[model samples]
Target chain A: MKNMTMGLAALALLAVSGVAQGADDDHRLDDAWKAAVEDNEGVLSPAQVSGLNILAYESAVARLCDGIKLDEKKFAASVAAVVTGGSALSEEEQVQRLTAVMFQLGTANGLFLAEGAMKKDTFCAHAAEEKADKDNPHNWQ
Target chain B: MKFSRTGLACMLSFGLLALPPLHSPSHAGKTADAIAAGLVGAAIVAAASRHHKHHKRMYYDSYEPYPDNGYDTYWNNVYSPAAGITCYRAQVACYKANGHFSAKWTRMQFADGE
Candidate 1:
């Protein structure tokens, strides 16, 4: 009876710690996003910044969820079109701009995936709900 | 006539040389016409290839999913649940308004929503 009681207490402790850790991770992500916005202020438009966030979240879902696939080529082409101003920008300018945007996206994606890994069950549930929604555009197929 | 072998050879050579040159003015004109025709064909092919390439580039530029006309704010806002709409739906509306809907966009909208 004592051993069973001890086991239950340990499980409860672990569950509380997991919840606390998840909250901490969420805060970290929030701070990281705020920092990203501050760092890119004036350099990137608000839309571009928001696009990066959306891309990161979708990428995380795509990576961790089953039956979801990202069309990387099409996504990259669309991103290139936007960054290059519909191919109006010079090659050098496009390269510079794309590099910057990709770096930001990479950072955000890394953070999102790291956080998602910790609470995979919850994250994937949310991801599945989002994917099932007809109106969501990230298009994880 | 019983001509010698050497004499026969010389006559044949002279007879061959006496005929009109293969590149007569008329023949040269025909050759030039062929060359001109070939050039025109090549030019047409090149122009068609260029047009195809330009059309592809324009298609990408036109159909890509970037926000315009202040839709960027909407895009940013939709990420939050407070917006009461998913980003995907917002994007569909945005693309439709801007006439940027491609076949893929059309299919997605048809499969998912009105």
Candidate 2:
């Protein structure tokens, strides 16, 4: 019984550590994106950077929500916060948070399309899949 | 689209106004300097306007009626070889009332202009 309990605890620790490592990787990727964009001669201002970020968010949301009715003002505000807030949140987290907010807003306001228009994939999951596919590159456009 | 004659005249006037401050030293020159500053401001605005026109002009040639999960759509004529995206913004009220999704169009240049 003692050995079995110890084994279970060890397995739980391993699972927690794996989750932490995945989160750390996400933070690293976010940092890389930030470093690449910051001080880039092409970007005229921080607001432009924010605009690019919002465009990307829109692309992901379009796929996830399909024909769902989107609230533009709310979406823009959430994206602006992520861009200008200077928070240490990972890019993945930022996308997920925005998705959650939109989901709640859509549900409350009856913004979702008819039953047939919904998508099963989450924004974060879609992003991860895109990142892994080297043949299809991601960019501001 | 070609720049309008009015825009050209305005630009020329601004250019003329910008020249006097470079040579004259009279008290009227001070006023010319202010005019020159204003001309520079106006020139900047004019240039920005022209740039906006030069960018892409995307619109839906056709799209499926809204509440349809699939957007079977085609883009309007390509004004330039410049790359841009056409995304459908969900405005249920607009769609429900008018049978069209709000076209979220932007005139943007892709990196490498491809």
Candidate 3:
């Protein structure tokens, strides 16, 4: 009976400690995000907002994949609050900008992969043509 | 026929060598090779320009997600939930006139890795 009582007490202590650790981690993430926003003068450009949004989404996906719990709303809310500061863009407009930039960057990366994949000769030829084009003064502007 | 053409070109060049040069190659005229290269370059430039125009048109056409009817349902259903917090909060701030949206719980799908 004494041993049983001691085990229960130990389990209860562990549970409490686990909860405390989780709370601390959450607080740390919150503070880190807040600091990141403040460093940007609380005004996030479309690209910056898109970057943070992508990071949050990727982190959430990773957590989901790992079967770990995530308070996605907390992270999302922090990012949104930062991006919204000192911005005249409507919420929809802001979201559209973020999405558009993400799509554009993704498309560029996809094009690079498609153009350069598995064929060094083709890639080199294209790179040379691009370089020759870059040599033109008018092309620079 | 290929050998005859080559022979004729060689004889022609040798015959032209008897005359005084009227102009340097740079000032005279474009060679067949240069002309062919120019045509290929022009075709490539045209194709690339057309492709870029098409891409630009496609992007501009789809840039705006919401019409005059608004994106309330889309905001509530598709985007807010899919994008989760940052977008959800921005949606709230930007569309205060559109009324409130409920916070959505994150849905995890392990089977298909969605």
Candidate 4:
């Protein structure tokens, strides 16, 4: 009986370790994303970064709740316009700035999706409520 | 011993499966940057306006419009692309909501650009 109990305790330890490792992996990935953004910190202001992050999160929520679709060609044109509009920066600087902005946007979106996955019922409920709001752009009805 | 090993393997597999795919950095070429920039920029523009409107209702707050300087020349560039990014974001949300969490599915969403 003692041997059996030891085995069960061992199994529980292994399970807890597995969960810890998973969480560690998540933190590492998040750190890497932050580092990538920091690499181009010279390009975007803190406000711009904060604004972009919020924009990314809401966009993810809106997309999920609303049934809207993306148009690639038009999006490309718009980005080009924004990039070119900053004529003060050299081409290389412009590229770096754009890359940094994208990293911020992608990171926020991915984090939101992960949050939704982990808290699906609550997240979906909130999303649905947001969608139902008549003034929300996510509201197609 | 064998049963314990099997349980450990299963737990590890589950943990791996539960993780969302990491974002891969693409090489920043002019064309690719433009496309990627447009994709994210458009999304930002769309989400910014939408969020502004939403906030307005909740807090009666006003958002700053893009500056009226020369930057205004390209502000209009965002409209159509904003729609595209909004659609892409929606597609991603749909994928996640439906529980399609595979890395391949996530990559395909990015590749297909919708």
Which candidate has the top score in TM-score? 1
1 or 4, which is superior by TM-score?
Answer: 1
* Cα displacement (Å) at residue A11, model 3: 83
Mind giving the per-residue lDDT tens digits that candidate 3 earns over B1-113? 01132332232222311211224565233332333322243333324434453212212222323332333332332122232222222111110111211111111111011
TM-score of chain A of each: 0.65, 0.29, 0.30, 0.50
Q: What share of the true interface contacts does candidate 1 keep?
A: 0.00
- Winner on DockQ (2 vs 3): 2
Winner by lDDT: 1
Give one digit per residue, the lDDT tens place, for model 3 in A1-141.
999999999998886554322222211232223222221211223334333333333332222233223344443343343333323444333333333323322332332333234333434343334224533111110
Better of 1 and 2 by TM-score: 1
Scanning candidate 1 chain B in windows of ten residues, the lowest lDDT window is: B93-102
Per-residue lDDT of candidate 1, residues A64-89 (tens digit): 87777766654554343334343453
Model with the higher lDDT, candidate 1 or 2: 1
How do the residues B15-59 of candidate 4 rate in per-residue lDDT, one tens digit apiece? 312212223444334446544544354444434444553312211
Q: TM-score rank, highest first?
A: 1, 4, 2, 3
- The TM-score of candidate 3's chain A against the true chain A comes to 0.30
Score candidate 3 by TM-score against the native.
0.20
- For candidate 1, the docking band is incorrect
- Where is model 4 chain B poorest over a 10-residue stretch in terms of lDDT? B78-87
**Model 4, chain B: what is the TM-score?**
0.18
Model 2 docking tier (incorrect/acceptable/medium/high): incorrect
In candidate 3, position B13 carries an lDDT of: 23
